[model samples]
Every structure is written in C-alpha cells, then in structure tokens.
Target: METKFLVSLMFLQAIINGVNLLRPPDQHGSKCSKNGDLNSNVLLKSRDVALDELYKSFRLPFTGAQRSNNGGIWAHALCPPKEKMEECRECVKDTIDFLKKDCPKQKEGATWSIFPHFYCMVRYADHPNQGNLAEWAWVQFNAPPGPGNATAGELEKAWNNLANTIMEKATEVKNLERYGYGSVLYGPHPQNLYGTMHCAPIIYQM
Candidate 1:
C-alpha cells in the first residue's frame, strides 16, 4: 500500500536529531524563475540587496522584505520561536547562501531548509504574492521502518495519533510566531514519537 502524509507547509515540525522517527525536511528544492530583461549582473545585484534586507528583517524570529521597482524581488525568512537568535540567523543564512550559489541569476527563487535545526524557511520571488498560502512548497522525509517488533498496524495507529496532536497544536494562534511542537508515546515501548509544526505568521494577516 502507498501511504501518504499530507502536511500543510504553513507549519514545519518533527524529526528529532537522533531518534530518526522521521527525517527532518531540508532544502527541498531551490526554484529559479527568469523574468523580464533584467541582465544577469543587475539580477544578482538586486537579489543580493534584497537578500541583505531579508536577512536583516529577522530582528524578530519571523519576517519578510521586498525590494526593487521593476518586477521586484521579495523575500521571507522564518525560524521557530524556540530557536536561539544566533542559530536562527545561521539557519536563515544557510538558505540565503543556497539561493546565492544555486540560483544566482534567477529573478525568483525559494528554499525550505532544515540546517542546524529542522524549523526554518527562506524564499524570494519577483511577484508580490509572498503572503499567498495557495503558493507553497514541501518535501516529505520518511522513517526507515517501524522500531522493534511493533506491527505495521500498531505503528500506523500511533503515528496517526501523533500527527493529529501535532497538527492541532501547530495550528493554534497562540502567538505571532504561530509554531508548536509535541511528542506522543509509541505503542508499548518506552520511546516517544515527536513532531513539530509552524505556519508563516503572515498567513494570519491574510
């Protein structure tokens, strides 16, 4: 049977460092779209400028910025609230570096990265719809297999319960950051399954 996990890109969560219950989503894809007559030099220049502002926009944990008049380059960066200031900046910087290296001249690009920690995203585009929920990207990471002798049925049941708890907790608008994390017991084992979720704060503005 083909099992599918449908997660809203709004909130990123789960996949702890060592347990390997899930592999944290990381740098799914760096999409680059060319537009207009912006020469390569001008494009990179504008992108770099916008990226600088984008990085600086994170005075708070979550923020976005826009630059240029011709088509424009817009960017957004997010890191979970629990993440440290320096680490969050580092995680966001990694995404920025990925865009700079992999998507040099493209007028538009976006990337969701799990560097340092699994809770971060950085995206840039020429259009102004950075806040559009309908436009999003994702990548799913699956665990190797059920741990111990827990049957597939038992494992699936435990996973469903964990996903539901995390989804509900993640969707709560408790703060402007709009992110949450939780863990649930797995079968009769002493081990607990973990997960986390986060949505772009701007989603609320819409």
Candidate 2:
C-alpha cells in the first residue's frame, strides 16, 4: 500500500513537471536512451578546467549551479530564482545522485526534477561537445483533460508552436550561450501546456 501511494505521488509530480517542463528540460536522455550512467559521461569524461569555469559562471551570473569539464564541456542547473539557492542545489544534487541509479552503462543521461521551481537540466558529454544543444534535443509534449473547450486540435497546435519556437531560439543562440522556454495555464485546469527544448548550442554548428 505504501508503495502504491508513493507511485501515485510520483505520477502526480511527473504530471506537474511535464506541465511546467522548464525551459530546456534535462540535457541527458532517458535511462533507456543510452547504455551508461550520466556521471560516467559528464563528470568523468570532462576535464577539471571546464568544470571550474562552469562553477563560477552559475553562482554569479545565473545564480544557479554551474560546472564544466574537459572535452569542451559546460553546464548550468535550473530552478526558480525565487527559491533559496541552497534548496535548488540540494534538489539538483539529489537528481545527480538519483541519475546514478540509471543507465549503468550508457554513460550519459539526465532527469528533470522539482522540490521547488518548475524544471531543471543536467548535461555532460564526451568529444569536444559544448554550447546550447537544446534545439537538437528531443522535444516532449503532454496534454490532459481540462476544464475548457480545448481539444486535441488545440493541444497539437500548442505542442508544434512550442517546438518551432525552440528550434528558432536554439538556432539564434550562436552555438555557445544558453536558451530555453516554458509556460503554464490555470483556467484550463487540466488543459495542455508548453515547454522549451534544449541541447549543447554547438549542436547548431553541427
């Protein structure tokens, strides 16, 4: 029974996360996407220098978590600016810890999470990978029953619109900076929603 309750809670959280899908979502893929763990790819593969630079960039300018590694890597964790940085840190830290539980071989993956704030991203890779890859990253959409007359037509339109925006913004970020998008609706109750996609901006250069 407890397990059932916990599953129910998790399902609820995922729905909310999907609804607010943060700007870029997570940089990593689903556990099934690759063959190993995210850290093995992100933390282990990256060099020390890039990680240090990333750390400094996040705290000061973004007020978020940041880090980079060799092989031209960089990352900035996501969260609401209003939340205590410590809390967001803890959440992201926990996400990393949990991410370890998955993709034991793929060596690359990320999971969206929330304790406070709408969404977040975790990224790391091999090769000379850098920049905002959000546009190239896979886009996901979700729409549930709602109070308004919004139908499948409205939901599909919203999803495509969001994808198109992500494609455009990612193209414009110059293959180095960062970019993301998101939205929320209350009047529709269970209406469809919108969110941004993300990637290593360098993906655009490719």
Candidate 3:
C-alpha cells in the first residue's frame, strides 16, 4: 500500500567561484512525529528489525530493506555512484542516528546529506511502496542572488537549462547506478555551474 506520511530532509548546495550559493535554512532538516508510541512493543520490534536488516544489506550504492515478516516496515538507502565504501557506511550510520533521535516514534523517515567526499540518503517507511513518487515529499532550497552584477533573469535561465538537461539525462540512465551529472557555464565571468540527479534502482507496488 502507499505510505500515508513522509518525513524527509533534503540538502542542496550550489557553488560558484569558491562561494556557496545554496544553503539549507535548517542544517538538520529533520522532521518527526510529535507524539511517539513508545509503549507499542510490536512496532518497536518491527522498527528495530527493519533497521538492522537495512544496515546489513546496505552494500550497493542503492539498496532497500524489509522486515523478514510482515511487520510493516521497509527501508531504502542510497549513495553516490562513486562513493567509497567506508564513507558511504559512515554517512548511513550518521543518518540512522539522526533518525533514531529526531524521529524516535516515527514510522517513516528520509534524509539526504552531501559531504565533501560523499553524499547519501536513507529512507524507511511502514509501507511497501516507498519507491512511488506520489509517496514522497520535497523541500526546496533557493540559492541567493548571483555573485556580482549577474541579474536574476540570467541566473534563472542558466539554472533552468542546466536542471532540465540533468533531469533528462538522469531518466536515460539504465541499470542499477541510475545517476547523471552535468555542468554548464554561467554569468559574465563564466564560472562553471554543475548539477547531479539520481533515481532509485527499482520500484515495487503493492
């Protein structure tokens, strides 16, 4: 079934001429349920089992996990195609720690983080169809005005072109990697503008 609620933390970063143009308003970008059902031992058991399996199965750049039985928990994790094994594991571990603290009672959670060496995402839900785009929520980060004399119109045009190209390329990606990246020239100074995108390896519906 489709997941009913979603909690996601997405980070976006844009750099130009050694200056960061995009930053998250909330560094944590954490979302959690206000009230937790701590006394629900069944749910707690399912959550623990699901998380354990997720960590164990998180070998590939993209992976998914589900409880051995129908405990109603499913999880997915992702790292950049070129991410190192140790770095990806560390990122996932840190992300899982954040979810355990910030979403203590939550049935589902997702987080995206980009580090200097690697980037990753961890998502878990009680529903099986977590791959469905309709079950996802998004947070947008707006970049500040272009540095120097570049107008908003010019910036938007360059960004749109780059974004569109990246998205299309991402769709064309095949096999398990499912990632795409590109860069373009921008502004009067002609600094480089870069973009990247990824899609889940597979989708399941129930």
lDDT of each: 0.57, 0.43, 0.54
Instruction: State the lDDT of candidate 3 residue by residue for 62-149, as single tens digits.
Output: 3322122237766666665665666667766676666677667776666655454355666666667665543233434344554456
| lDDT, residue 108, candidate 3 | 66
lDDT per residue, candidate 2, 12-83, as tens digits? 122332344343333333332453334544454452334334424446344333545455443334454444
Residue pairs in candidate 1 whose N, alpha carbon or C atoms collide under 3 angstroms? 10-198, 10-199, 11-198, 12-198, 13-196, 14-196
Best by TM-score: 3
lDDT of 2 at 52: 35
Candidate 1 per-residue lDDT, tens place, 1-206, comes to 11123354454544552265333435344655545434666665766777777555456423331122222555667666775666667767777887677677665666666543444666666655654433334445544554556666866777677666766675666644556667766655546666666665543221
Clashes of each: 6, 25, 0
On a 0 to 100 scale, what is the lDDT of residue 77 in model 3?
64
Error of model 1, residue 104, in angstroms: 3.2
